[model samples]
Target: MEMSREKVAVVTGANKGLGYEIVKALCRKTTASYLTARNEEKGRRRSRTARTRPQAEIPSAGHPPKVYQTDQTLIVNFFSLVDFCETISPLMRNGGCIVNVSSSSGHLSRIPSQRLRERLKDENLSLDELKVLMQGYLLAVKHSRDVEDGWGESPYVVSKVGVNAYTFILHRRLAPRDIRVNCVHPGYIRTDMTKGEGNVLPEQGADVVVQVALSDSRGQYVWHNGTPVPWCGDDPRIWIDGKV
Candidate 1:
């Protein structure tokens, strides 16, 4: 992997909250930084607030969206992050870093099933396999069997867990390129997800993101305070506050 010193970073879901703050901070430190929000108009507005807003494509964490939206959460939270990484990786003028905004709700214990947790934590897990697993979940959802099938009622939580798992797979895949891929739980920020109720501020969460972007680390799972945490199975109480 040919590493370059140029500070080029890409942040998704940056239309508001922590993602927005991360892009803002990166602009001050990096030669080039881009903010991508799914809403084009919203992305443009956020970009204008940054010192070096560079135009680029955009991409969310989650909420218990409408019934139809549960599936969309998985698409945006898990698949979009992976797709965006694949799309932008080759275009990186300088070796880059991918920071996925995950949540404590993603912790393995939140899964509640040993079988599913084991499969998710499989070291040999592939992106295709993960997709298949998620497809099954969606199917179960469509049939109103996801809960009985042990996939859990909250698609939002399952989606982030998928992101955590993908973080590991992506880290290994991108290692050869020296382009780090890491996931961070930005604590419970006062974002829309929390309905403006949270212990951590938006910028405090963004601090973790900015640190990871500038570091040499690869494929790490961390908390908002920069503390390293296990990305896989462990005590749920260790991270999850009370489930999202």
Candidate 2:
């Protein structure tokens, strides 16, 4: 693939871990890159180590509303992503790409209800419908009825699922403009978020993410090694010791 010096990329949560490595990797390919983090000082400190100068330091409102902590996960993982896409996509130049950093937990199989899975994967599923589904999930959580509703117990997992589902929705919306949008599972990486208990390194995970970000593939849920993983149905890859 040809690297473009004129291309610009932006990474969020880039103070440390996978997002930080993604910034470093993008610097090697794109001329301008920007990073956002909850902590201003840490984001500035990390940007100084990159090969290219950061275009800007974006400070994110790190904390969610004082509602249920589970709601916080949904806000950060799903809602914020939707907001970011809606806000930045129109400004992006044609042919620009958007890669949503997702997890294996985002796979459709993770949701127990086959009906719910089908609902999320429907091509006709609109952004408004997605919002309603997400709100329904939050309501389920509030009432301690998530599992019974087939949404599962882990808010993190459900949030990632939402991210993956929204990727397809956004991809369809942006296709006419030649803007490719996809999500990827960056493998289980040893990062601060995981308490350093993962098999893959942050740099290794970021490499796959950067690859997808610069590729022509659209509406794909890629595995860490650059393979496209099915969003629905059984994943053929064996899970050894809970690691893919």
Candidate 3:
């Protein structure tokens, strides 16, 4: 995949933090990228109005000037991803990549509450049903900003777990189509998400994304940088012994 031709990519929650940094890296490595933030107005306000901001110029500094309105719910996230795939996938270059920026907080082990565990494990539930259930989860988070409530530390963390599950689902959905879909736990990067408290820098976290995007591997779940993030339970690996 050479750099000149149009190569479209999408990064959700990208107006700031790791998502923004991932877009910055993708822009430099690819031809074009759709940076999706829940707040499109904020995206537009913060992004340069020059009609063309160099990919390298992303992550300049400070909060993005524009913020668009979006529902901070699991349903919205899933629909947006599906809509982007349906609308944009056709125009992308052959080696285009989809990087779902997730976090370690999404793990089942991270959710200590048995009730939450039972809810997430109900496989008979459809995606739509899961989305509905997820609302309750988000509400729980809002009620208690503390992890002790079984909501993790933040709503974003819970959503990322959904994103990780979505990544696996997308990998299956796109596998036969030959499009690459993968997720990465970019680590706790020092950014707005962690309020700049993380030890890792955004650029450092981005290194993991670059590795996944550049590698021939497809439909894989990798953790910080290029290491394979172990699959939970009986879910089979996206890749065969060594191949996808």
Candidate 4:
């Protein structure tokens, strides 16, 4: 494939499943597709195998932090996603797109606390503020009040919700650079992440990811199955406040 100056991409956890398919599609358009994961050997194998790979951290379960990796999930999923976007925005000028592969469970409505959701949308939400909010969840987990407190049983959903909220924040920050940002839930594909339990094929999930990656779409939590739905999984608060 011919490399292009205008388009280049990086995908974390792309070695298999939806992320791998994403790299495959992006390779057709981007000059270079950087595929990375925690397992370097596996990453290289996939990169050569696909012509790809994405991610860090263990999948979340509703358990307290008995070890280090579980707590690190919050850092990897939210902080890293934000930091990566901030760093890449300067380089991706003139209509570059960042697509954060997310999940439908990330929909803030899934989180029952109006107060917590509002904090996520805080106008001055800084990295520090975000950290505080997440740490609150950790405290809740420690005290065994996580479920009643509305973080739910899985930290995975909470982490993804953070991804969704920050996608909105980064869109506003990056708009001046003409770089659009968005997130997508790739429709529950059967992959290692899902332990091969999902209903969709990997390619089917990837087509949507490729679509958003190449488009001017921004601040959207959309999905691509047989039909595409834009502005999905939005918090009712956004609609209530008319803030997008």
Candidate 5:
């Protein structure tokens, strides 16, 4: 992509939280950003809301708004990401970049049962198969207040695992065309996802993602920052004796 020409980026779940911060960083450092949220009205409202607040009325005597708190937003979030990717596929210059903002929860070994783990290990899983797997997780979430209790207590964990799996899937399809497809664990950043518990900041996480998007064309999985954070042992090539 030309440095002078405007570049385009699509960030999912960007109304607030890390996603919003990523958009802010990208707008500051990169090119135009397509800020995506599950609810377009809500996203626009947030923009309006941010502007409407008086200087004196703001929290901490006028600092900034924070992450949105909601329990059942992921269903819409997944579909929003899909929509963004599909809509932008044709407009992408230099084959574009895709950053699936996953979590360390995706790498958890203690979440899934042995049978489910074995099932995920199979490389031949079809899109239909993956859908069924994901559906099972949604169902679990719907039926129980606690998703972990319902479906091994790893909905977020399993969703991210699926994300990592799909990253390689997209990479295989795009690498030949020189379209970069990669995944990153945002290092436990303090966002709604981490419930403000993580030590890392949103700006720090956004930097890592921006680095990968801007890196030279290399067909590899990476977590870009000061250095590449390797896949957490789930990758068979990197895994040795049951560790990454």
Candidate 6:
């Protein structure tokens, strides 16, 4: 696999908050950057604020401009990731990396069912199987049985969990191509997603994500301060009081 002289990056949900910061951080190093957001206007405005030359400002199609809705969360957080990987991975030069922004809430301990946790932890889990799991979560939500079915009440949590799990599978598949993939819990930062209630600032969190994106680590779930957290193990309490 040959590496490219010019680096490129793409960030999703980058109109504001952590995503915006991530784009800013990447712009400092990458020769080209592309960002996508649910709100086209805000995305363009924020891109100007970042003062980075974005190659494209893609708008998420069919994604309602809402937060935390189960179906929408899955679409924005998980399925959109799938779409990006399939579309961009082939274009990425060797030695490039993909960072999936996840949250500590994605920890397997957040799931009530041990069986479901074990299934997600399977090293042999395929992309098709992962999609089935996501669909099952949606079905459970439709029936108002998510909690009883072992998934937690937060669609955000389930979506991030899916992101973490998918990171592992993607790393395995992309290894031969010399393209690294990792998921990051960018610390509980003061963002709209957190209702502005977090100890770390978005720029601080973005630094960590940028560090991981340029590192050689593959398929690991990392904390905002650059520590690796077990995606399948119990919660490491990294988010308590926004402590790194």
Best by lDDT, which number? 2
Q: Which stretches of candidate 1 lie over 4 Å from their true place?
A: 1-5, 51-66, 93-95, 236-244
Worst 10 residues of 1 by lDDT: 52-61
Please give, for residues 122-149, the per-residue lDDT of candidate 6 as tens digits.
Answer: 9999999999999999988888899999
Write down the lDDT of every candidate, Cα atoms only.
0.77, 0.85, 0.60, 0.73, 0.58, 0.82
Q: How far does residue 240 in candidate 3 sit from its true spot (Å)? A: 23
* Candidate numbers sorted by lDDT from highest down: 2, 6, 1, 4, 3, 5
State residue 170's C-alpha deviation in candidate 3, in Å.
1.5
Candidate 5: misplaced stretches above 4 Å? 1-5, 39-80, 108-115, 137-151, 217-244
TM-score of 1: 0.84
- Local accuracy of candidate 4 as per-residue lDDT tens digits, 1-244: 9656555688987777787887888786754789887789888988888842333234646545532433777778887887777787777756778888877667777677777877776757776677778888878877778889977777887888888878877787777877788888777787766766888778789888888777667777776442333333455335432333
lDDT by residue for model 2 (1-244), tens: 9755488888998877889889888887754889888789878988886643333333444655423767888899999999999999998988999999999889888888889998999999999999999999998887889899998778888899999999999999999999999999998888766666888988899999999988899989998878887899675245423334
**What does candidate 5's lDDT look like per residue over 1-244, in tens digits?**
5465567777776677666777777777757777766678867765454332212111333322211111233343343444555576566665667777766555535344656665654567654576577666665566663345434654455666666656665666666667787776666676654557777887788787777777663434454233444443454323422334
Candidate topping TM-score: 2
| Candidate 5 accuracy as lDDT | 0.58
Output the lDDT of residue 176, model 5.
Answer: 65
Cα RMSD, each candidate:
4.8, 5.2, 8.3, 5.8, 7.4, 4.9
Q: Rank the candidates by TM-score, best first.
A: 2, 6, 1, 4, 5, 3
Off by over 4 Å in 4: 1-4, 29-31, 51-70, 226-244
Candidate 3's displacement at residue 207, Å, is: 1.6
Better of 1 and 2 by lDDT: 2
- Show model 6 residue runs off by greater than 4 Å: 1-4, 51-68, 238-244
lDDT: which is higher, 2 or 3? 2
Report the Cα lDDT for residue 151, model 6.
Answer: 92
Cα lDDT for residue 183, candidate 5: 71
Q: Which stretches of candidate 3 lie over 4 Å from their true place?
A: 1-5, 12-16, 34-95, 113-126, 136-154, 233-244
